[model samples]
Target: MTGGRTGWARVPAPVRDAGLVAVAVGDAWLAVSDSSWPEAGLAALACAALALRRYVPLVVVLLTVPATVVADLVVAPLAALFALAERRHDRRLLGACAVLMAAASAAPWPWHDPDSRDRTWTLIQFAYTLAGTAAPVLFGQLVQARRDLSRRLAEIEEAREHERALHAQAVLARERAQLAREMHDVVSHQVSLIAVQAGALQVGAKDTDAREAARTIRSLSVATLDELRNMVTLLRASGGRATELTPQPTLADIRKLVATSGIDAELTGVLPDTVSTPAQRAIYRTVQEALTNVRKHAPGAGATVELWCEGDDVGVTVTNGRPTRPSLPLPGSRQGLVGLRERAEILHGTFSCGPTPDGGYGVSVRIPAQPA
Candidate 1:
């Protein structure tokens, strides 16, 4: 039954109206008493009025009344009453239209004197016609009710989906807060101890190699602690509350980054003042990641960090020489380069990394002065 209704609804409105007009015209032709002009004209008018039923339903119903009384028409008037009932919410108005339609259907054409028997039979026919009019009006009201119910159900479902989304976000915020606490309480404490021990070893060790190794460990541990503190701050701020964030790195910080990188590196060149903050951050991260990779993979290699501007583009290039010693095996997710590429794409820029011709590694990134 639902499929049948869906198929019927897919029919074009004008086509449906044309079909109803055709049905009404056919009923009028079969029921009219004679080929007289008055009767035939009224029947034609009633059928034609069905075309306007959806827009002016009450007017259409009234237009059909003359044809009903004159030519004993049934389909045209009933169809008009159904249309009015479907669109109108006033019960009194619908009741009045239904009564008018029944009266028209039962009345005699060309009024004349009648006997008692004729009057009694007319009364019986009037009651039967009144009962028949009820069917179309009731059915139209039922269809209206079903339409409202369907809309209400859709609204209810949408509200439920929104509530589910909010609940999921709350759960995620709580989990982030818990993770932040664990990093601060346990992970941060452990890394702090490691940094302290490495510092002490660097101070006490007499062998040149041992002191250098301890110094390198201490430097790496301090960097790790700084990053962990930043992460914890961000995670704890995830619950829609405002908090001051740690200042982000920019182009001005590039020189300091190179100095602290613990590798022999040179910094040169200047970017334009027109470079956007995000673009600056991208360039800073590029140099930082490149230098870190050199320390890990190209041990004892010297690096060059160059910042340059050409036309409307500003960029950074970090290139390192081949390692002087074999690099120790280190666990890595290998996501650093992938992340740099994604960031460049977001800023409508370009990033490239590969081995240099001098048996060294190179990382370069160029971004627009004003990103889109």
Candidate 2:
């Protein structure tokens, strides 16, 4: 990757090379400032050799070795050794550079003077040279290791992020499928009623306009049913049928539900003839589920169904008396109430079911006139 403006771009290879050249020139000038003509020439040659250190580091170090004997031109050898260690991990090259630096450091002292050529002084010079050479090599290896570790960590984080995104997509797909199935149930039930009413109109209507209207309603219902079937096909992978073609229960069907429940049940409500289809369906299902629960859990108890409309909202409450007989050990899927609650909430309605103050179970729902 290319460097960004405020980041790694600040230190390009050309700029780094230029800085190294400047350091080499400064060191050479210091060494030749008060030396003989031969020493000055050698210093200039050593500084020139430093220019090639980044390209052929070993060759440049070898070239600078001769000049160090005449003047202390350490920049070329030190820079070359650092570059070699950073770019190559060959132990032989490092050992060769260390030996060369030791010779150069000892060359600077006056060996002809017996006092200065003592064992202690020679050993000290060799130690200093070895330290200078070894420090740069160790630092370069550390930098390389750090870069490798950082790259590995970045790869791991990227993989984890990809996995998280895939999981979120899978969840979204599942939710959409569930919504489609629920929609098919509700829409199919309402459309079937429209088809039934249109059939009745076709049989009873006297005028031409009324008959035509009934025919049109039947056609529309059939077309809607076809579309709903197609939607279900696309949403589900393998389900028997998208929706039931048979008639579904509505508010008008509550009487039938109560009679078949077998429990002592009481239902009282005054739903408007023009109530919205969704509201009627919700009321019907809530009562039917409550009656079923009463039969399963309270075998012989009485239950009451109360429904009331206040302003723009309609409410239904189903309550049962304490069990009169022993409860049945019926196996329950346990998803009935949860699904009902989800259905109400999706339509911007409220549903709640729990134990009543009278030591019996109660289920209640309040729905808006128009869904949001």
Error of 2 at 203 (Å): 6.5
Global lDDT of each candidate: 0.80, 0.70
lDDT of 1 by residue, 80-149 (tens): 9899989989989998888888888888778788789988988899899998888889988998888777
lDDT (Cα, tens digit) per residue for candidate 2, span 96-121: 77687667756643336545457677
Spell out the clash pairs found in candidate 2: none
TM-score of 1: 0.56
Model number with the top lDDT: 1
TM-score of 2: 0.48
Candidate 2 weakest ten by summed lDDT = 237-246
